[model samples]
Target: MTAPHTGGCRCGAVRFEASAEPHHISYCHCGDCRRASGAPVSAFVGFMADQIALDGKSLKTFENGPVTRSFCGVCGSPIAYVDERLADQIYFMLGAMDMPAYFRPTLHAHVREQLPFLHMPDDLPRHLKTSVPRPSSSNPDGTQS
Candidate 1:
């Protein structure tokens, strides 16, 4: 998907605009993500934090370990996820986007935690854990060096 993507919460209490193409896009089958989103799997569209602008008075955040997730307090719509390991990027929940069909996930993460009943017959690359690499000065692109 291209730039200027827009989206909001179910109640329209929170909204966001991303000014650039996503840096990463993937489907996560981790238990945490499943539980948080109340779905068997969750998809995210990642972008540099600076490339997105959020507007909401009902936005709330929850921090767990090195990750912080944000949602709309009014409707409990999951918004974004930020991991300290990838401090420069923010992953927005694909379901919260206005045109979710436009964003195609390139990979599957936490496959080991996927539900046995969920059968996604896709050829996308699968990872036992997260596919995102920790970013550092030597790995500015968040890729393994």
Candidate 2:
């Protein structure tokens, strides 16, 4: 299903679109995610990075040891959470996208930092940390079929 949604950086200079459907959707409460988004839990929809059209400029990435966080240089919006091992897939902040409320945590990562008031439901897999899978394609760029 094609959900024609669009969003941009805080400065509104950078924008993106998921012409097709999304890949992974989740709510992450990790420390890195909190710091990156300045929220208790950050929502994201995974996508083939190259699949999402970036109309303005590219992102400015910050390497925090094992992972890197990227954002629009013009808007400085929290754009994605990227693991070096899974460079093939990128998680675009769900809250950043202009779509209906689609908050479903497929898996909870970083239980240590999860809000104490919030208890995870057994329906979804819970993990201390998660490593999202790369798309099936083997292209150097993050474009999917």
Candidate 3:
């Protein structure tokens, strides 16, 4: 079997491994993501929840409505984001990945909420809202295929 993708919090208080290749990758410019990551934009790698194993005592979670975000309780490094609608999948913060450079975002989400000063000069497809379709389970990539 291939080696699992690995990552951890800044202080080494939280660590995780994903056994499967990511099914989706994208950049989110929504205000919620920005506030959660404390960055102008947040990139994520999405994997089936069952494929991820988080091993750490400092993992904590915050819930707002249907969204629950996980972070390192010790270093406060953002970890993963999950939405009730997409409960089967977990979106891990790209910045927390051990090899963030290996994952390239395929699209940009919530473009309408993107900060005016943040200019990404890429030809990636941009969506005004979440790229993932709601009430969806099998197609996290937001593609009809």
Candidate 4:
């Protein structure tokens, strides 16, 4: 595995260190993700929550359906997305990483909601929703496959 990954908010108010390597890196085209990052799509890397140590009293969260998004209260930089159903993992926005290029997304999720004006230049698999193995619970992002 590579060296420990470290990152923080834009204002340096929030910081985190992850020992374990991430899995299921993805480009999410879901509306919630777009809204959260103010981008047509958002790239994220998922790691076990226990593998990370987060700091910053300014970190705040917004629970959206089954996911809670954490960010820096001062800079409002989107930090991570905690999925309630997947209690063991946390999804950190790829762009927030100090070494964002280290993580390479392998798939696209929520493609059904992708905007017509947006397009990606990759041949990775695209799923209507999550590509991560998930319980058959109703998908909070949209319809289940």
lDDT comparing candidate 2 with the true structure: 0.70
lDDT of 1 by residue, 3-57 (tens): 7999989999999999999989999999999988999999999999999899999
Compute each candidate's TM-score over C-alphas. Answer: 0.91, 0.73, 0.90, 0.91
* Order of quality (TM-score): 4, 1, 3, 2
- RMSD per candidate (Å) reads 3.4, 6.6, 3.8, 3.0
> What lDDT would candidate 1 get against the real structure?
0.91
Clashing residue pairs, candidate 1?
none
- Which residue pairs of candidate 4 clash? none
- Report lDDT per candidate: 0.91, 0.70, 0.91, 0.88
RMSD of 4: 3.0
Off by over 4 Å in 2: 100-103, 119-123, 131-145
For model 3, how does the per-residue alpha-carbon lDDT over 37-67 read when each residue is reduced to its tens digit? 9999999999999999989888999999879
Superposed by TM-score, candidate 3 places the C-alpha of residue 57 at a distance from the truth, in angstroms, of: 1.4
Candidate 4: stretches off by over 4 Å: 136-145
Error in Å for residue 6 of model 2? 2.1
* Model 2 CA lDDT for position 23: 73
TM-score of candidate 1 versus the correct structure, residues matched by position:
0.91
Q: How accurate is candidate 4 locally (lDDT)?
A: 0.88
